[model samples]
Target: MSHPQAKTHRMSEFTESIGTVTFSGIPNEGFLALGMRNYWDGYFAGRAAPLGLAPAEVVHAVFYNFADGEVARHIPWVWGKTTPEEAIAVRERGSAAALRQMIGDLADSSGLARAADLATRAAVSAPIEGRALYAGLRALAVPEEPVARLWHAATLLREHRGDGHNIALAAHGIGGTEAHVLCALAHGMRPEEFGRIHHLPKPQLAAVIDGLRDRGLVNAAGGFTDTGRATRERIETLTDELAAPAYDVLSVAELDELIAGLEPICAAVDAAGD
Candidate 1:
């Protein structure tokens, strides 16, 4: 027999799920989002240098999972020791190599510039000032260079989507600790690592996991139950829903043209894995 508490917990999650999905913008946004995100991820990863970009520079910029830029919590967990002022400098300069690394290969392909120009135009058409994540990124001034503007625009769009994800997770009572825990497990990481990355105390992380288990989302073994996986999937679907207005500036054909333009560049970047 199901416990009364379990049933109550599920009901709460289901209610939040509805509230979360209701906030999604529209359907058109998802069609191009993955490609745009992948493009930025690859381009940025190439910024590594001697005091160069690490995971921490933008971790808090894109996410509120740490409440603020709590770089110490996650940075040392991955990099062990960090140099003084590196984080501050990255925010200022943004790894000077970013433009060179990402733009060189694109020089041979005009599509990259064309797609970026289109995306930059579309990104600005949306009502983004009120969205917290987008607002944070938008507050940063874009450089004069075309590719730099493109990167900033892409980052703005990405953070806009991230804000929606945050909303969905909160609606379901999944705070930073709970969300990170499930995601870490889904990615085959240990619970201790999850705690360090998100700066959760072990007792608190364990408590969140226990709560998820009661709701039938997390297994005792730190893996996802079918319920857990299903919930994560639904939240992501809703995130795209809320992210739709950003793409409303383009017609389906226009978006298709943009995505088509980006495909080869993204594939090449993906293969390089830098």
Candidate 2:
């Protein structure tokens, strides 16, 4: 079932781009109408809904990037307001609606439908061991609508890949907070921006950076050292290898088709600029 000649890296890049863009527009009207307190409420509850009212610790363990106590503050508590199934429904509808609004006619294009079909096959065939989030998503029915199906497939693949990425990070001794610091440095993002996203205080963020520096992964200026860049590269390569099996169901032609079909959608979403 594997195609060694398939362009695995390119496929991973395109899928990651499409998945991240599709997910960014969440907490849309349908989700907000669910009476959640804020964006975080909908985000945590909706994404974790597939896990069916799991504890914050379970979510935090799988999510693997939030600072301490962040997941606990919102989970189970949000479930009190809405059941997991309802949250899943709202998230699907909201994600599909947002994609339609952004891409116009492209959301309904035959090209997208083809891409969805291919992506869904890969997602469903992906290995589920050690991938809690993806397993939950893969258990759901693929939506009949093209846009919704595409979103569902993209998310399933994303979480499948993400779970592998977390495994890679942990194997390298990178904890959640430290991983964010390393990611910020790798992406040329300011450490402050990462802190803001994870709600890490200045002191805590500095501690993470200092630890990376001490380990020689980062310099005093918070940029990656040679060792850091190589480390990050190794982690990414391993992550790609781990995720490659998901797309192994497709041949080179289908992989190329999936990327070509998704490229325009990703471009449009990027151009929309939030």
Best by lDDT: 2
Q: On residues 154-197, what C-alpha lDDT tens digit does candidate 1 reach at each position?
A: 55565566677788787777776677777787778876775445
The segments of candidate 1 whose C-alpha lies over 4 angstroms from its true place after superposition are 1-62, 67-96, 139-142, 193-204
TM-score of each: 0.62, 0.93
Could you tell me the TM-score of candidate 2? Answer: 0.93
lDDT against the true structure, each candidate: 0.52, 0.82
Worst 10-residue lDDT window for candidate 2 reads 20-29
lDDT of 2 by residue, 12-112 (tens): 66666556543555544565677888778888888899999799999999899888899998998998789999988888887777777778889878998
